[model samples]
Target chain A: MIYLELFLNFIYVGITSFGGGYAALPIIQHTVTKSNEWLTSTEFTDIVTISQMTPGPIGINAATFVGVKTAGVLGGICATLGFVFPACIIVTILAVIYAKYKKSDVMSGMLRGLRPASVGLITSAALSIITVAFFGQELLELTFASVDLIAIVIAVIAFILMKKVKFLSSPIAIIALSGVVGGAAYLIQGALV
Target chain B: MKEKRNYKILLPLFWETFKLSAFTIGGGYVIVPLMKKKFVEKLGWISEEEMLDFVSMAQSCPGAMAVNASLFVGYKMAGFIGQAVSLIATVLPCLILLTAISFVYVAFASNTVVKAVLTGMSAGVAAVMADVVIGMIGKFIKNKDVISVIIAAAAFVCVAIFKVNIIYILAVACILGFIINSRKKGAGK
Candidate 1:
C-alpha cells in the first residue's frame, strides 16, 4: 500500500505539473510536505538543494528520496515510475499524432496562458525557498529579531556575484560555493560566540 | 522520417538519453538544448524543425519537461518499445544517485557541518531562482498579451500572498488561457 500510495501521489504530481522546472516546486511542496506530511519543510528544501547540485529534476529526486526513505529501493523505483508515467503516456501520444496537431490553436492557446502562469508559479516557489533560506520556515513568519542575518547576507552576496561576475554566474558553481562559504561563516561565528 | 520498429534503435536511444540525464543538472531547460545537439546535430535522428516541435511539445505537456522530451524523441525514433527503454534510461541515473544519497542523507543531514552546507546551498538556490524569475519576466514582457500578463500577475498574488494551491491557480489559468487566447485565433498574426 505504501508503494502504491507513493506511486499514485507522484502520478498525481506528474499529471498536474506543467511549465516544468521551478514550476513543479510548489506542487511538490504541496504534495509531499503539506498534504501528505511525508516530508518536513527542511527536508523538502534539502531535496531542492540536492537537485540543484546534481543531475535530474527535483521531481525525480523527491520521488526517489522519499521512496527509499519510506520503503527501500523498490519504493524509489515505484515512486519514480509514478513520476514519469503520465509524462511518458502524454508525450508519446503527442508524438504519434503531432504531425497533424502542430501549431493548432488549442496547443498554442493553452501554452500562452500556461507559460506566463508558470512564471507566477516559479515566483511563488522562489519566495518560499527564500523564506526558508532566511527564516528556517515555510510561512512568511518574519520579524527583524528572528531572521538569520548570515544566511541573508550569503543570499545577497550570491545574488550580486551571479549578476556582476561572469565567471561566477554558473548556477551550480555559485551554489556550491555558497554552501562552502555558509558553512565556514557559521562555523567561525559559532567559534567567536 | 520513417517510423522505425527495429530493436536496434532502442539501445542507441536509451544510451543517448542516459547520457543526457546523467549530465544535465538544471532539468528541462538545460537538458533540452543538449538533446537538440545530440539527437539532431550529432546522431541526426530528428531534424532541426522536428526538434523544435519536440521542445514545444515537451514544455506544454504536463509533467517534467526532461522526461517528456526524452519520451517524445524515443517514441518518434522507434516505437512503444523505444519509449519504454528511453524512459527507464532517463530516470535511472537520478534514481540510482539520489537513492544512494538518501541512504546517507539522514546521517549527513544531522551533522552540524552538513547542516551548514545545506543551509548555505539553500541561499544559493533562492538567489538562482530569483534570477530565473527576473529573466523570465523580461521575456514575458516583450511578447506580452493582456490576458497572459493578467494571469501571471494574478497567479503570483494567489500563491505568494493568499497561499492558494497551485493546482487551483493552474486550473484557472489554463481555462482562462484557453478562453482568452482561443478567441484571438482567427489570424493569429
Candidate 2:
C-alpha cells in the first residue's frame, strides 16, 4: 500500500514538475511532507541536501531516497519509475507534435507563459528552503528567538565560498565543506557543554 | 538502409548519453555544454541550432534536463527505440550509484556526526537554491521584459504567500500568455 502510494504521489510530481528539478521541490515537499505525512520538513531538507550531493537529477534522487525511507527497495524502484514516467510520455508526444508543427503560435505562447511561471516556482522553492534551513523547527512558531545563528553563519560562509572560490563552487564541494564545518562546530559545542 | 543505419547508431548513442550522465553534476544546465560538444561537435548528429532548441525544450519540459535532452535527441535521430535507449542510459548510472549509497546511508543513519553533517549541508543547499533563483530572475530582468517580470512576481506571490496550487498558477499564466502573444502577433501583421 505504501509502495502504491509512493508511485501515485510521484506520478503527480513527474507530470506537474515543470521548470526542471528545482521547481519540483515545492511539489515534492507539499506531497510528501504536508499531504501524506511521510516525512517531516527537516527530513525533507536532509533529502534535498543528500540529493544535491549525489549524481543525477535532484528530483530523481529525492524520489529514490523518500521511496526507500517510506517502504523499501521496491518503493525506491516504484517511485523512481513513477517520477520519470510522465516526463517520458509527455516529452515523446511533444517531440512528435513539435516535429509536425514547428512554428505554432500556441507552442510559443505556452513557453512564454511557462518560462516566468517556472521562475516563480523556483523562487518560491528558494524561499521555502531558506526558511527551513535558517529557522528549522521554529518555522511553525514564527519567532525571532528560534533562528539558529550557527546555521546562518555556516550558510553565509558557504555562500561566500561558492562565490569567491572557483573549486568549491560545485554543490558537492560546498555541501562537503559545510558538513565538515558543521560537524566540527557541533563537536566543539558538545565538549564545551 | 534506414534500419541498418539506426542499428549502427544506437550503441554510440547509448554510450554517449551514459558518459554525459555519469560525468555531469549540478543536473539541469550543466549538461548543456557537454551535450553540445558531444552531439554537435563530436558526432555531428544535430546542428548547433537544433541543439539549442533541444536545450530550451528540455528546460521547459518536465523531468530532468539531461534525460529530456537525451531522449529528444535520440528520438530525433533514431525514433522510439532510440528514445528508450537514451532514457535508460541517462538514468542507469545514477540509479545504480544512488541505490548503493542508500544502503550505506541506512547503516550510518544513526551516527551523530552524520546527522550534524546533513544538518549543516541543508544550509549550503539553501544557498545554492538561492543562487539558482537569482540567476534565473536576473536573466529576465536583464532582458528588460516588464510583462515577464510581472508574471514572475505574481507567480511567486501566488505560491509563496497565498499557497495557491502550482497547477492553477501555470494555467492562468498560460492563458494570459496565449492572449498577449496572439494579440502581439496580430498587431505585428
Candidate 3:
C-alpha cells in the first residue's frame, strides 16, 4: 500500500512538473501540505529552506524527505527513482528522435522560441533569490540596507572574477568569500543595532 | 583510433559522468563551466559551440538542467549506451549524497557554519544564474531578431510578475513556434 502510494505520488509530481525543479515547488508544497497532510506548511517550508541550503535539486530533496517520513529507506529509493524516472524516459526517446531530427527546420524554430522562455525563467529565479537574500521577508519599500547592497556588490564582483579575472574561476572560493562577507556584516549589524 | 572492446567505449563515458554527478554542487549554471572544462577542453567529446547548444536545449526542456545537459552530452558522446550510463552516474551520486546528508541533517539541522556557508553560496548561485541569463541574452541579441526579444519579454512578464503557470507558458511558446515557422514556410512558397 505504501509502495503504491509512493509510486502514485512520484508519477503525479513527475508528470505534472513541466518547467524544471524550481517550477515544481508550488506543486510539491500544495500536495504535501494541503492535500496529503503529510507535512505541515511549516514543515514544508523548513524542508524547502534546508533543501536549498544543501546541494542538489529541491524536488529530489523534498521527495527524499517526504519518502523517508512516510515510509522509510525503501520509500526513499522509490521516491528518488520516481522523481528521476520522467527525465530518464524522456531522454531515451529524445536520444533516438534527436538523431534523425538533428537539423530539422521545425525543431530549430521550436528551439529558438524555447530559448527566450528558458532565459526568462532563469532570470526570474535569480532575481527572486537576490530579493530574498537581501530583503529577508521585508516589504519592498522598507528594505534598503548596506549589507544587502554589499551582497549584491559581492555577487557582481564574483561575476566579474568569473568572467574576466580568469584565475579566480572557482565557484567554491567565491561562495566562501561571500559567506565571510555576509557573516561579517551580520556581526557588524548585531553590534550596531 | 577507436577501441574495439565492447564495454571500453561505455566505461569512460559512464565514469566521467559519474564523477561529475557526485561532485557538482549547486546544480544548473554552476556546472556549466565545469562541463565546458571536461567535455570541451579535456575529453574532446563535443565542440564548444555544441556544448552551448546543448545547454540551451537543456534549459528549454522540462527537468533539472544538470540532468538534461548530461543526457545531451552523454548521447552526443556515445549514443544510447552513453545516455544510460550518464543517467545512472548522474543520479547515483545525488541519491547517495542526499541519503547520507539526510541522516546528519536530522541531528545538525541548525549548524552555524553550515548555515553561513549555505547563505553565502546561495548568493553566488544567484550570480551564476544571472551570468547564464546574460550569456544567453548576448547570444539572442546577436541574432538581431525582434520576434525573439518580444517573446522573451512576454514570457518574463508572464512568469515573473503574473506568476502564470509554466506549463501554459511552454504550451504557448510551442504553439507560437509552430505558427511562426509554418507561416514563414507558406510565405516562402
Q: Tell me the tens digit of each residue's lDDT in model 1 across B1-189.
A: 655378878778888789878756544555544554468756899875466457556766788777787888887777778788888888999999998888677665567786677677767767776776666566568766566567778988997889776667766766776787767665586
Better of 2 and 3 by lDDT: 2
- Candidates in order, TM-scores: namely 0.66, 0.65, 0.79
- Model 1 local distance difference test score: 0.75
What's the CA error at residue A179 for candidate 2, in Å? 3.2
Off by over 4 Å in 2: A1-79, A98-102, A137-141, B1-86, B89-94, B97-107
- Candidate 3 stretches with Cα past 4 Å from truth are A1-8, A26-43, A70-72, A137-142, A145-147, A170-173, A176-193, B1-65, B182-189
| Residue A125, model 1: Cα distance from true site in angstroms | 1.0
Interface C-alpha RMSD, model 3: 3.4
Minimal lDDT window, size 10, model 2 chain B: B24-33
Q: Which one wins by TM-score: 2 or 3?
A: 3
Give the whole-model CA lDDT for all candidates, comma-separated.
Answer: 0.75, 0.76, 0.68
Clashing residue pairs in candidate 1 (N, C-alpha, C atoms within 3 angstroms): none
lDDT by residue for model 3 (B1-189), tens: 543335565888888777665445554545665565567766788875566556556655565667777888877767767777777777776667666666676554677656655566566656666665676667678978778777778887887788887667766776787678878989999
Better of 1 and 2 by TM-score: 1
